[model samples]
Target chain A: MVADSLVAVTIRSLVLIIVLLTVFAYLMLFERKFLGWFHLRLGPNRTGPWGLAQPIADGVKMIFKEDIIPRDADRFIFKLAPVISLFVAFAAFAVIPVGPPLKIGNWTVPLSIADPNAGVLVLLAFTSLGVYGIALGGWASQSKYSLLGALRSTAQMISYELTMGMSLVGVILLAGSLRLSDIVTAQESLWFIVRQPVGFILFFISVVAEVNRVPFDLPEAETELVAGYHTEYSGMRFAMFAIAEYVNMITVSSLVTLLYLGGWRGPAFLPPVVWFLLKVSFFVFLFIWMRATLPRLRYDRLMAFGWKVMLPVAFLNLVATAAWVAFR
Target chain B: MATRSPEYFTHQGYEVLETLDGDRMILSVGPHHPSTHGVLRLILELEGETVVRCTPEIGFLHTGIEKTAENLTWQQAITVIDRMDYLSPLSNNLGYVLAVEKLLGLEVPPRAVTVRLLLAELMRIASHLVWLGTTGLDLGVQSMIMYAFDLREGILDMFEEVSGARMNPSYFRVGGLAADLTPEFERMLRDWLQRFPKRYEELRALMEENPIFLDRVRGVGAISQEDAIAWGLTGPNLRATGVSYDVRKAFPYMGYETYDFEVPVGTAGDTYDRYMVRVLEMWESYKLVQQALERLPDGPWQTDDRKIVRPPKHEVRESMEQLIHHFKIVSYGFDVPAGEVYVPIESPRGEFGVYLVSNGTNKPWRVRVRPPSFYNVMAIPKMLEGNLIADLVSVVATVDPVFGEVDR
Candidate 1:
């Protein structure tokens, strides 16, 4: 039984990496094209038909470009920073179930690579660790812009992570289980989004900040800090950071889908993965839309908004969830 | 192009170069930053995200255009001045040519004068459209850049029809115009007049009251009226302080004395007010264009005197005397009387003034340009004091300093 489960785990690990890497590339292409429509301009239509190969072109270009390290940089940490970021970005997805278990022959295999009992703990732990990559990268580069960007990014992460984790507690209380599959299963009757709308909203805003997307995108603020923490990184190193960001975006969107939006739950017309994909795509589109519409929030104001506003709203949501669960 | 600056330091020591004050960081925002608008460099003293002091370093784009102007003849100098404030090239053309005309004591016909007014207003709208688009981009609204520039494209097409070039159209001559307007130029402008009001309303609806944009701009880069004046701020930057000091109102040119238009002024001199002033100015410019189009009279496009303007190409081809006059005007170039004149015009930015000194030869003895961006950018440090780094960007955006003009 152990050997069979181990084989199943190996297959799942390989599949997740391949699938997520592909999704990250396509998500970038989707964003550029969608943002172009918002701007009433054509975006990268010349690479292949309808610019379908634009991401591939971007990858090739980034890979071939020269990677330069500053003379004053810590060479060991400078090389290690992106690796840690890319690893954590991919690792955060290990706990989230992609779909229901598959039954083939005599063995039943779960879609998740690691179905830990405390899945929320695992995800949050990984999310918190993701900042070290940015901070270390900035500190190592010895460039002033990177250090500022790194400082802003690290502070922003700490501020928003509280709201992000607290927002999920209301959903967790309702589900009555720490496992992500149970979170999805509890929403079979009615998605948590309908009952916990306030939680979802707070969580969504925090996720935008946590992922360093627009409005909360001050850390990598191209206008202020050049390319931010990744200013000194180039070639495949920069590409790694880029991919890590997109993967984090996807991971959060799916977590939102699984935890609140009823992951893989839909009518008889669509398959489970398709339904999950559709839900995640909706959040991804919303992220890109926010980028097109809003301006970056001031750093101090962003901190104030997170602590004073979002944290209290999340706490109120948790209390409301507990009361409803107790009475019902 | 790299702008070379001497190394910056608070103090000099072996350990000091490595780290100073330990808590405070000195960050250089640009000669290469995305939001500096051009090659404007700000050496910022940062206490965390809050900017303690911002010292702006200009002259990255200085090409000595005024020095270059002294070498060109009175007629040939329009080409050089247009490249100064590239966004509002025609306004530069108008200021320079008006200076020359004032020196020569030349009279422009109603047709030429009216056409100049119409083109100048169009240039105003075009310049503001670029400012609106780019400012939105700096503040992180990605779609506004494309939408705003779309309107600017229509204005450029109109420019191409009127002048041979789209950008640096040296169409305005010393006395009048290089050539007459196209037969269908009036129709294209009429279409724009009918269509642009709705588009302007749409642009306002998109961003003016947006909560995110409001949060970024409202009361963020506040500069008082007293501070604005003390800093020598003029144009919309000054007008946003509720100072009604438009050059057109104070010193009318191109028969601006007769044109009925209101100068839009603001109460609180902040980024939002500056944005409102520019948008309202576009509306006012559109109104001015409509008025100029309706009142355009039937007359010669250039001055009647052969010494001031070249004869019509057909006349030059057919008549020997006309040919001689055209050759003399085109080759030798007409001389301005020995005198000095300073003509100030209400350029899109603010007070775009040109000072001219003629020595009675074909070329100008000395030319000096008082570019509005030069004065406006000088007031940046005043606005950015004690504000956060983000507000620093918004103030720069509000100033709309074109480094080309600032450095030139």
Candidate 2:
């Protein structure tokens, strides 16, 4: 019986990793294609029909490129940074269920790899760990731009992570559980977004900042720091950092899906997995849309916004949710 | 390279540094950076993210254009002069040719004067469009570049129709223009003139009220009017300080006195003010183009002097005297009376002046350029010190120094 469950878990884990990695590759193409349309230009249309194979072409090129270690760089840490990033990114997905459980003759198989009781805490912990990759990558590079980028990432992550945590407290209060599955189940009647609208907005903003995307993408601001923390990374090492970023983006999108958008729940016409994917894709599209339209915030201003505005607002939301939950 | 301490950087007379407050890191930004506006290098002393000292190191794009101009004849020299301030090549051509005409005491016909005025205004709009787009790019508004460049392309098409070259046309000649303005040029100009305002409004909507953009630029890299004047800033950089010292209005070249337009000025003298002045300047240039097009006159394309202006191809073919005159003008070129003249005109950047000394020969004895970007670039330290590294990018964009002109 242990052997049977072990086989099922292994298969589920393998499928999750493969599917996630594939989605990360395609997400890059989708971003570029969407940005191209926004800018009134043709995107990647040369490699395959309508640029379908562009990501594969990009991956092949990344694999073949030369990997350089800066002469003064901390070689061990520099080598280990991207691995940490990609590993943490993929590992965070272990608790996020894609669909409902399936019964096979005598046993039941949960769709997720692990359904931890403290799943929400695990998600927050993993997302916070993402900064280490960028910070270490910057520090280990021995480049000034990288050092500054690392410094910015450290400060920015600390400021926004507080708001992110506080924002999630409101949802946790409403759902009355730390398990993400329980939170999704609580939203089966009505999505958490409707109950905690302020929390939803705060979470969305903080997640955008957490992912190091535009308007908060100071660590790798090309206009200022060239390529920022990963300026010295090349070949597969560079590809690893990029993969980590996109995968984190997908993971957070799924979190938003599972926590607030009614994960794997939709009309009867479509299957649960398809519904989950569609909702996650919408959040992903919204992220890309923000990149297209908005300019980056200044470093000092971003910190101020995170502390003075986002933190206070998130705290207020948590208090409001707590009061309502206790009274009801 | 030698390792220098923070005190060493401080003791080197980086005038911008008020006091060395803490641990400093020296960072070299560009000669190859994405946003230094081409080959401009800045040695910055940083305290965390704040810039403590900024020393602009130029000459990286030095092509020795002024020296190169000496080897060519006065008529042949226009080609090299167009290379300086390459973004506004027509303005460079106009300045050089007008200086030579001043030396010869020649009078450009009404038609040539009108055409020169029209093209120069169009060039101003085109150059400012480039500044607008790249500055937007530097500030992280990614889509402004595409919209701005699309608008500039239409003006470049008009230039191509007139001079058969898009970038450095060298269309202005010693006594007049190189050729008559084609009907194709007029048609394209009319189409562009009608479409430019809507396109410009679209660009303005993206920037003018954006909170992120405003936060990045406002009160950042501000210089007072007295300081701007002391630093020898001109053009939009000076006007941003509320000086209202436009050379077109003050000196009045190419019959600019007849065109009624307001010189836009700003009060704050910060990066945002500089941006606003240039934005308004584009619309003013559009106004000038509309007025010039309405008053377009038809007559002789050049001054009727066979010694200076080359004869028409048909006349040169039909008559031996005209052919000899054309051959002599093309080969030996026209000689200016032994005199030196400096003609200052309002280029797209600032007051672009051409100083020419002719020793009664076909070639100029000396050709010196008073490039506006040279003066504008000197004020970098004044604006960059005490700002953050990101503000350095914004300040550099607002200054709008074309390194081709800065290091000419």
Candidate 3:
């Protein structure tokens, strides 16, 4: 009976994984379409009605693309890097609660794949591992730009990761729980964004830097470092890196919604999943809006900001939150 | 033996030369770089990250525009200027036409003057948007490009309403505008003017105080005011160095004096100062456009000179004389007196001057353009020396030289 239950749990987890991956693929298309609207241009409407098939086309193209490894590159590390990046990025979703539990006939299943007591810690570990892929990819390429980019990625990730981790301490303290679902429940009265605007801002900026998005994207500053760490990467291997980045964008956005905006909490009419998706979409749109509006920061400035500005702000927020929890 | 103690190396035909190991390294930046602002090449010698020497190689976008101008008549030459600094073609058109208008000795009506001022300011904002976006992109800010382009589209729409094209409007004729401003165009302009300042503030919030942006730009590519004047750098690039020199203020043309606006000057003349100057200038341009719109006088859009301008469209249908004049002007074009005139207009890049020798013919004998970007680009080497490889983009973006103008 125990073996049967274990098999059933594994099967249910596999189903959830498949569903999330499908959502991730469509989310990319959704971003492209929305960003296009924001820019007053049509994005991708050719493949199907409103470009529904565009992502599929992209996937097929990526699959058929010629995979090339640089001659002087460390073959083993280069091959392993993208896989590690993609695995870690996708694996983080397992801890995120997409919606409330659903019951059908005799079976009841949670929206998330797993709900561990240390869910937040597991997500952080996965994110930390993602940087290893970037560092390894840069080091393995053995090119100057790539090396510089990898070095930047290492420094940026280490610096911003601290702030990112620290910023979340406030959320953890408020919820008094590490599980994402439990945190969402705690936010039923009011969202963390209202109480901790500074932390939210810090978290948002650090994540943007961590993902190497615009303004903080020194690791892949195209004009200066010529694609930075990924200068030599090509074909589907490059596509995997690209996909992982978009996935991380989605993951971070979802996390922001859950932590600050009050996860899956909206007016009575909409379903819980719909509210979750709506909040996630809002954050995703913000990311695109920011990418389209601001200029990139210089490498020194980016490093300085991560160390000096974001770190201090995050620490202050953490202290304030701990004090508030104690006093309350 | 008589070789007398074998004289030192110098007397033995071996010359001693001094070598400095720490001399600046030579690096060629680009002909196809992302931040050269469109196909500009800069040869840089660096003492580590500081630029020791800079040499700008242009002519990539040169289509022999000056030579091409000589073949075309006064009116046809306007099209040629449109190709130079394609970002602010209206200003180019205004400069060329104003030069020809001076030769013809025609007075543009009040409406024409107002329209010219309005469009010129709009073009300045549009051009600066391109600068802001591309510069931001060069500095690794991907979103600034989108914001720049978004603002630019509204201005382009206004241009298209008046001139029927987004780029290369060629709307400004010799004595006046090609067409009157439509009612819809005016509404769009008023709406945009109101919204632009707020949007600019939003953009500033995103970038200006962000410590990273400040550090990258503040002290990089600093040029002294004396060196800037000596180098013949004009426009915002020159003004960034604390010089209060502006062609519009010093030598007013297109009735720029009538507008109430201030020329923003910077103290440091560094990359950051140049950026601040441009951003501040956009607001000034916004104010100018608003003033021009409010005080715009109603009158004939084009100059009333039958000898120069073609007769009205209504008269052409009935009067044989009008028909003949129109046919002659379109087919052979009008002639100017045998003399040379140099007319300069304040373009977004800088002072765009047109020197034309008419030779009492339909086509000019020789036409030359004093392009501002050419001079500005020459200052790159001086700017880059002793700066880091990363600071190269900052310097390039701050200069804001459009290759079309430089090459032309």
Q: Write the residue-wise lDDT of candidate 2 on B63-86 in tens digits.
A: 999889888888899998999898
The sequence of per-residue lDDT tens digits that candidate 3 reaches over residues B191-242 is 8988898889977776786666787898899999988988889899999998
Summarize candidate 3's per-residue lDDT along A3-70 as a digit string, tens digits: 23666668866886676567767878877887677666788999989899998998888888888888
Cα lDDT tens digits for candidate 1, B33-55: 88999999887777877877777
List the lowest-lDDT window of 10 residues for candidate 3 chain B: B1-10
lDDT of 3 at A325: 93
Per-residue error for B40 in candidate 1, Å, reads: 0.9
lDDT of 2 at A159: 95
lDDT of every model, 2 decimals: 0.88, 0.90, 0.83
Over 4 Å off, model 2:
A1-4, A102-109, B1-22
Rank the candidate models, highest DockQ first.
2, 1, 3
Q: Share of real interface contacts recovered by each model?
A: 0.70, 0.61, 0.59
State how far residue B257 of model 3 sits from its true place (Å).
3.4
Candidate 3 residue spans exceeding 4 A from truth:
A1-13, A37-47, A66-78, A91-125, A139-145, A162-205, A250-295, A309-328, B1-34, B42-55, B104-114, B133-151, B175-220, B290-307, B312-328, B386-391
Candidate 2, residue B183: the lDDT equals 86
Off by over 4 Å in 1: A1-4, B1-22
